[model samples]
Target: MKKLMLALAVASLSSAAIAQETYTVTDVPVKEKSVETNSFWSNWFISAGVNYNAFYSSQEEGISKNPFNDRGKFGFNVAVGKWFTPGLGIRAKFDGVKGVQVNGGVWSPDNIDFDYWNLHSDVLFNLSNMIFGYNENRVWNFIPYLGAGVIRNCSQNNYMMGANVGILNTFRLNKRLSVNFELSALAAPKSFDGIGYKASGNKIWRGADKVFTASVGLTVNLGKTTGFRKAVDVDALMALNASQLDALNSALAAQQNENARLKEELAKKPKEVIKTDYRKEYVGAPRSIFFNIGSSQIASRKEIVNLQVLADAVKADSNIKLKVTGYADSATGSAAFNQKLSEKRANRVADELVKLGVSRDNLVVEGLGGVATLKPNSYNRRVIVDVVK
Candidate 1:
């Protein structure tokens, strides 16, 4: 039935959180996080772009100041930077050529046209990587930066200290190249713009000379790109593997003994009535499909055995409707991330059932976000199927 599905995606081992790591259901262990650091210059990059600049000053308030009327407010920008880590980086950028500015203590219909350059070093923070975990292949990244620098006004032959802030949006075209869009604003001392308190009845304005720019550019990485790689704990994984094998062997033996005991008990009783083919032939099989932490794909071929038996039963009786539920552990990821992970697990199981000859219409697939229903959280990262009615 179609209905709202709540998924409890499960895993004691974390995919994104290292140390709060997660384990898998297969014999071979998988490492889902990275903690290694890269060498210097490994993540360096350079970019170049043209931008339309806008200037504003409190002194120009009385007049309608339009950047379009100021032909000097158009220029080019360039930068070179490096990512020290997935979430942090730094860059030195230059934007300039010519710009319009209001002169100190003077108000003019035609502002000063000044040839200059603004150079600043920014500390970059990749918001996406910081919040969602590092995913190198991620196409888009949102980076905000802050910095301080100096602006040289060539016409006035003077320099002023400046500060800047901005957001940089990057769309990765490949491992080595990215298309970038940037929005930034810079602030300088009012006197640097030839405008001072003396120009306006000696009034000290609250703001300074400001320039805003919007630009699009291309960035090419200077060297090899380094990404985080999973940390391997061989001894721990081997121990885990041994314990998991023991558990599986025990469960299988117990189930076999139960089946045999039931068969003997039935033989000792009176003749039973004939049941339908689906009910009479199929033996009880585990109805849960397990997966690795932070993964939806079935990891082992053995996981499909019981699922195959269930598929046959559905084929024998097409009327049977099975409920397929998926889950992820709450300990590994954020709620929103777990919700999506859970749905993927459920859908993967449903797809497998369909492959096994079960009609899609006869299946109700839902995700239950994150839960800790099982002893070991790794077992919870799975899809569970049962008869709907």
Candidate 2:
């Protein structure tokens, strides 16, 4: 819970600091990050491609196993799909032209191919998007799917049921254009091929038919809602504001306790008795200016009024030497960065002292880097002004 609060506090402070300024990272401008979301009508696409359809059957167990010269023939496919999220989607596809097979379960090169159409609707999963986060501008994406469809041999007027599975690879060319490569397999009853060899040589035909395919095509995204936009949560920001208020109240309480301690220490000190002929020495209690965590600027210029009083005493005594030291919290920033930040803070306070009529040569400005001498991390982010004897 402490870690969460610290993160939220940093975020809240950053939000307030950059409310009017804009910054960039790498090439893209920075924006608040959130989840990807789209409406039902968004992310819809259509595609068309040519494929090589290879028919598989246990009946042709011993047929020549050369792919380019086998019963696999050229065909075409068209599909329509929609992405529901970065990881999931659905697609309906139509594939067919002609499929090839052997007559009498024997290899004779007699060209016994049949005309058919296969329609399948599959639940698609984008592996790239699911594994890595979604990037609409990403060049390539890998997707796989599974579904059931109807297969009809138009030449024989026969219809059968089929199950389908496949992997799709797409390369994005632009906002609306993509090149697609797909590999798929479908399984159906052997009779759906319209090959009436009835007995597969002598015995009765059995088992299912498999069609393996490899296709290449192009896709067109339908509309403008191609990617997700980050959303700003108003409620979380409001909570951060409340947390910031609590932090300020705590700082105020710390300051009050510090004032009471200073008063107690002063009461114990002996009073100085200077004769009328003696020169008065420039004297004052040590003063400190607080800052917000990780910042070098003074949190409040209210401390400047107190410094002005110290400056007047210094102007009266040329022998008075004052040291202005700055520090950062040990909990944040790198050692080198904190050192530099402290130096900057000390100089900032010294400049203010000079503006109030204190001689620059009498003021020694130094930075002690990071320290934890004070309670609460915020108290460590401060600059102290003390008389140097």
Candidate 3:
């Protein structure tokens, strides 16, 4: 019994599982107009470039050489950048510039070779993608940036805080790599060049020092052909999950209901067991209909009337069933002939019950051969009909 119950439980669960379908979560591409819907770790880029820097500072007559005669210096910059949106990003950069001339006044007429290192944190904007939307195959993009950070003159052992602004032009080579051209200007305090000039017997300060820089570099994207990715909408995914759940529940309910009906049908079916004699108790009084010896037909109209009355009673209550037993006189013909006659009598009575509106299924017909007897042989050759409620 425990095993049966366990099997039933497992079957029920299996039905429920079959009713509820399973789904796998997949990456769905959704297009939106405004926001970047990409992976958080995507769109990172690093770049390395060589730069030419030109410096400008306050000069004095008769003491300052022409700085522009051999002005520009060689430098290199490296930057790591990330785009927060399709059009906006930030970069942290380092630059090392050498071979710059910091000229002195009358005290030191010669020029001193100077080198500087700069660190910058800059905000970047992609003008091309902003104006035309993003296109991977587009050959060129124009980006501009503004930054402020520290600059250290390694040769002079001095540090100064400054700001720079630049415009970058990029040409795409493939999805992951690009070539970049940049033009920028840097400005710092007057003492940034580490030179103080004396005029009229007093040391004087000048305007800010400025450097114009131009560079070319290779930019490499960190991951994927499409530099950026879009973010998935949480609400949309939640709604889909809820809808799928509702459908699963409805199917499960239907499966459960079907399983219950099958269980009921199975319970009602007859099982294989040992056959036993079941004594039937009758409802109301037992009635007898007499028949002539050797004749299976109903010869008397009185017998027919009695059969009709019994049929009506059984029909009135569907729960009532009738047992019809036919008997023959023991002193009559051979036992085999008497048994056949008895069966015919029983069947004739059952037919009458059916014609009188009683269901045939409600009448159980049987033949008892010439074995049992009553005092009157004529009465012995008769069919006995009794109601089993």
- Against the true structure, whose lDDT is highest? 2
Model 3 per-residue lDDT tens digits across residues 69-158: 445678899999888787889999998777454464533536566888889999999998888876667799999999999999888899
RMSD of each: 14.4, 15.4, 34.2
Tell me the tens digit of each residue's lDDT in model 1 across 1-389.
01111000111111112211222434334344444578886889999999988877645555445555553367899999888888889999998987777533234556678788999999999999888877879999999999999899888888889999999999999877899999998888876666653235545443577788889999998864455544556777889878877866775566556555545555565354323333322323237788898898986778777787678867887877788888898767778988999999899888888888889988998998988777567877888887754
- lDDT score at residue 303, model 3, on the 0-100 scale: 73
Candidate 2 regions off by >4 Å?
Answer: 1-34, 104-110, 196-206, 230-389
Clashes of each: 31, 0, 6
lDDT of 3 at 35: 52
Extract clashing residue pairs from model 3.
37-229, 37-230, 37-231, 38-229, 38-230, 38-231
True-structure lDDT of candidate 1: 0.74
Residue 251 in model 3: shift from native, Å? 23
